[model samples]
Target: MGDRPERIADVEGVDLAGKRALVTGSTSGIGRETALALGRLGADVMIHGRDESAGEAVVDELAAMGREATFQRADYASVDDVRALAAAVREWTDDLDVLCNNAGGLFREGKLTDLGVEYTFHVNHLSPYLLTAELLPTLADDARIVTTSSGAHRGVDIEFESIRSVDSYSGFRAYQRSKLANVLFSNELARRLDRTDRSITSNSFHPGAIPGSGFARFLPGPLPRLFAALGRLPMATTVAEGAATAVYLAASPQVEAVSGQYFTDCEPETPSAAARDTTTQRRLWEESATLLGIDEPLADVEA
Candidate 1:
């Protein structure tokens, strides 16, 4: 924990006037901070969450900061909800400049959604996948999609057969699997977008651990506090600081031509073997399309 990196001002001086960005799960934690940072950079930001009151509060906070912001609520677990959210958001603006798929949490037990996907897979992976796919038609060329992943991905391999395992499960293991999926999704998606000539880019990151963020609210109280205390001793980055990498990936000129890369802090890094395996990457993309019931395969990346 002592070696955890400090936040750097990576996106300083970048301006995003006229750009409309949406950050999911933004009612609190890194998502909230990311939304604010984008607003501060002059983007018209949309704050998203399941809680309407909390979402409105964030929108109000953004307004007070002189940033144009709005709120949208949806259970990311619900595919219909995400589809409707995409359609509804389109009414406000024609083209989205950035989409941050940041909502997700670790559940202590395995759960399933109406869609029959495992709860962890739904919230942590499928929700973002479905939402981004639904909204693809509305993104501008060079539009950025940032997925907040985690170092926990190191815990698991890409297990197609066991990914949705309900019988054998641990909160931490499920979380790791979903996070690995994020990076895999990003790699495949970057390739897909490259083939389409649309210029949209997708990338994922390891936003350093923020121990007591909303993601842990489901955990028993004393446990989170204990981790928070330990985190302050050098293991954890604050939510505001944790958001720096994402802001850089979305706005910094250094990465303007970079795609299909995983980042930590402000620099590109090699992801795990599973993340770099092109076969696994393509398999995950195809599996995700089937899981989401999307008939058309994503466009192939031009070789």
Candidate 2:
């Protein structure tokens, strides 16, 4: 699923020794690879996931690399849980240098969470939105924010009303909308950060189809088996290949002044017309804050 494997060495001067980073959903797959790559390059990483054991295992692995690591557990379906994660991170460090909003997945059923939002959208889009708001003050000046979007975002456009409840639901469609929201939220965040005169840059990327990332486990019936088989194919995208753009966005000096862009294989590319709509971007940003019941962050950005 990858065109060319992008390596950490591809980006020069990527040493992150004095940086502190947090990667959500770091327990496995692309998230794990992204977190580890950052740690290996010298960023002390905070790992997050629902599984305590798996989360701690990542932390321990990072520790062995001599990078300070901590594990924070939270359920993306719960707003309080997401807030608690950011609060816990605040207690650990005040100068977080890199934030990878890499958590989220496709849910089999489209049901509403307690937050009255569809499960997939809430977990993949809203949770990260809330977490970013909660942790804004904690981010270091010039910190990097990288969100893991997907090429799946290409064809879908989000319906703000439908996020509250889906009547005729298709899992794949829900996933596509959520991914599109990732791009919109990311681009909008970059605009807001810049308008506010903040140096924090926000960007998102498509990590090619990674069949081996254990993501196939969520697929229905025989599809999981099909994906498992595809994972072993010579052309299957490796987890490292899937994680490249994230590492590039997180640590590369090339993008130091770059923001609000969609990327593939470490190079900026134009997203779908729907994804690039600044009108939709602002709409999504406002709707997200309303759903989370929080005052819009960086009020000055919009003022």
Candidate 3:
């Protein structure tokens, strides 16, 4: 936590009073900003991150704003940690109104999780997938699942075999593929929820090119310096701006009936051809469920 107290800014035309939201990776950057924004709009916000002190600081900030808030700590790299997080969330609330999957990063040196999945894929995709499935029973009928995807996913496609194999791993490629998985996961999840008559909406968004938001800090070399310099340039998006679309999807009434869409800058946008493939979306969903050992169809898991 920093010496300065957290700043609370009011967002107009949005009121989340009586609603509950869980925002992952809220220790800093866009995730932190998003959580704070939700709190400003009067949501009961649960801020999550691996750092206990930072998470507690955010909880304190939200509490100061007269919002009900709590902190939960979990490392996304471990499946067991994800399960613990989901269980803790269930204990905290019986019905969740918003689930923001905003925890992710680039692993410069390729590594594998204990489950043998590539580190980037495991954290950025599989962990959120598993967490969302495990918490399905607690979601409200009109709950929003806002996944923080990336524009970097434009050309990448999911490589099921490669996600578990690091023989020729490239960190950038793995991250891109994981972002693609976010979009595909949202797509398939929306379809399944529709079939099951659940009003839950699933959507993913590109947070824009945010340079100071931990996206480049993990780069192996001068790339980090390069990105840092670029972040100071006038064209780069700030953390607050990067969080707008997610906040929009989470609280806006215009999208109340919208689902299975890719969004950028608070507007529905078409994803890459690969991301739009129905068959591929289905395959990715089923494969993700298989990898997570989830036997139930996720759409039917509601309580």
Candidate 4:
């Protein structure tokens, strides 16, 4: 979040003119492309990533497109960094029109973060949960919160007791659980927003097996090479294709009033039966609040 010079302040060319958006993990891959598309639509984009150089490059790209852009560096592995990122966003703009939680990964080993939570869960689910909660006040009245969940969540369910524990952990299983959390978080968020009479739209989507990005590189061992090879084939989607659903959710007029649904390929699709359990969704929401020490009320209390 260091000082960076502004490249341009004009928003005369696109449909999102005068809007402000923040896309996390936007230094490369789907996140970077999403930021670029948003900028092209005339939004002032705020890019977030751990790499300063990559973030700066995205900012410059947006600037060159006649859009105002800035960079905020934060590592999701640390809760403190997420908090700092939220604060930085608040200071930058009073109301954010769009927020894309696109930063997530699969860790090879299960390690605890500074918050004593599993690394994969911490980054993919908990970190975004905390950031969104902290920045709630900064969101515009009709702000859209789009999360990049995965189709891998189909067979998984949230194991609340073992979420923070690394005992008997597998990278693939952990990633699946975290992705499920994303869908549940979005569903629960939509419910809470509904109760509060808020206009904010909260939704999640599957970007579809994106092969050439950091996703492939972080995979363990030969899997990375195999995935990279497959990515070069006709079946794998490119970074731009992967970012399509996210960009659509962020800027599309058709979904302007939509909330709390899982989407793929720009269409609303039903999530797994487990992801649709309201009881579990509520339980996860409360547990997450407890884990993060979020005392502020999220919605009106039920009778």
Candidate 5:
């Protein structure tokens, strides 16, 4: 997680001039900064969030920079909403070149969603998984999918039984499980796509602990205030710093050949051993499909 990959300077020269991109959760914090960065590189961007006014503000900013920008409101907590978001994106462009599955959060309440799934897991992992699957046909041939994972995924393993209920749920533990699922889902997606005709690549990354990135607000009690205080420290990771790896993975030429990897600070650091397990990866994919009541994606590609 060190060596920071030169932050925004790493992707400065990449030109994505007619490329179209969708960055979910772009209305604030790391997502907003990532949207702006991609727009600066000349990719017409679709900004996504549940807030219309905030989404429009980002769109306006991108427009000021001479990039085409539009807003779509979708809450990741609902499968219907994710489907609608994918439909809306398809209407905008069939050749989406970059898809950043960045709209995730820490749900401290640890409730169950309508699907009877843990809210944290459903929001952070399953929703992105569904969105990516829905958009597979909509992605361009060589599109890059960048997911926002975290260093917190290191110790835990994915467990469907635990995620289906909230009893014994600890916010941090649920978060760790969900983030781990993000990597597994991302790696599995890359493997499945590799079996197909397209040259798409999928990768996940740790954005570091960014205090002002709006996630801290979900922390219990004075922890949010403490996180804010830490943000003022001399070398605290800025919100822009938190988004740097995502921007790099989305646009940099250096990683165009990389797939199914977990990155930290824009470098391909090996994830936990559990995350690297292919069996777990594929199982998570199949189970996710079953939970959503959909046919297994890329099923004809073979195991």
Candidate 6:
């Protein structure tokens, strides 16, 4: 998850005027680059993070580009903070054209949130689910919803017996579980959207790793710099390059009619065998809804 995946060739001639996009974790690295690109394409962008200073800096960068951009702060690790984010979004606008669940955190040690949930799981997985659910009503017809996932989701499976990882704990393993949850959530979300009146399309992508971001969060000292240098060679792509697929999903015409599938480089790629198991995905989705106290059927909601 520390290296970039293959980049999707950029699409030619696209426009996204009058569109409003909200990208979480957008204050730096790939998220920042993605938001900037979308702004350049004429979308009104909302940048979010826990860091107000960094968020304002990104907003300044976008404004300098002559694009409409604003910053919002919310701690994705806290459910209360997520609720506050939803409230803030409501105050901004009732209609949304796109929502990119790009915010996430990485943890190497065992820590629990105030809610007693695992920190990594709540930040990376639950926060996205809650935010998406909160914003579902605001999405316009044919709107796009993209979630940033990781290639590390390859072999992980949701362990229903221990959703919070109270017993077994490894930073990488927990992250993998959260990512796998994202793909399953995307698929199930598409099904829900299809059953509803709204034509909002939900999809997820493995945005390749950008060297100074999450993966380096716990890298030991100079080791991060060393790996980043090596990654500059044949291994890693720049944040802009890494975010191409996400940008494609957000605005490209290539996937206008495509939804629910896992993507890498703007192409449909088969997910891990575990991810393809519908039964497991459904169970995970149901369990997640229960955990989040979502009683409404996914299909009953208007997109």
lDDT preference between candidates 1 and 6, better one? 1
- Give each model a TM-score: 0.92, 0.96, 0.93, 0.93, 0.96, 0.91
Question: Where does the lowest 10-residue lDDT sum fall in candidate 6?
Answer: 1-10
- Local distance difference test, each candidate: 0.82, 0.89, 0.86, 0.86, 0.89, 0.78
Candidate 3: residue 153 lDDT (0-100): 93
lDDT of 4 by residue, 1-303 (tens): 011001121222338889999999999888998898888788999999998999999999999999989999999988889999999999989989999998998888889988778899889999999999999999999999999999998898888889779999889899999999999989998888877666999999998887877786776779888887877887777777778788888887778899998998788999999999999888888888788777733845421
Q: In candidate 3, what are the lDDT values of residues 1-303, reduced to their tens digit?
A: 121112212235677899999999999888998998888788999999898998999999999999999998999988889999999899989999999999998888888888888899989999999999888889998899999999989878797878778888898899999999999888888888887667999999998988877678788879888887888887788788788888888888888999999999888999999999888888887787787777746635322
RMSD of 1: 3.1
What is candidate 3's CA lDDT for residue 154? Answer: 85
lDDT of 6 by residue, 61-147 (tens): 888977778888899878888888888877777888889988875567767777667777788888888898888877778889998
lDDT of 4: 0.86
CA deviation > 4 Å runs, candidate 1? 1-7, 231-235, 300-303
* Candidate 4 lowest-lDDT run of ten: 1-10
RMSD (CA, Å), each prediction: 3.1, 2.2, 3.7, 5.3, 2.4, 3.5
lDDT of 2 at 31: 93
Q: Give the C-alpha lDDT of model 2.
A: 0.89
Model 2 lDDT tens row, 136-160: 9999989999999999998888988
TM-score of 4: 0.93
Query: Deviation in angstroms for 171 in model 5?
Result: 0.6
> What is the C-alpha local distance difference test score of candidate 5?
0.89
Q: Extract clashing residue pairs from model 3.
A: none
lDDT of 5 by residue, 200-261 (tens): 99999999898877788888889989988998887998888888899999989899989999
Distance (Å) between predicted and true CA of 77, model 5?
Answer: 0.8
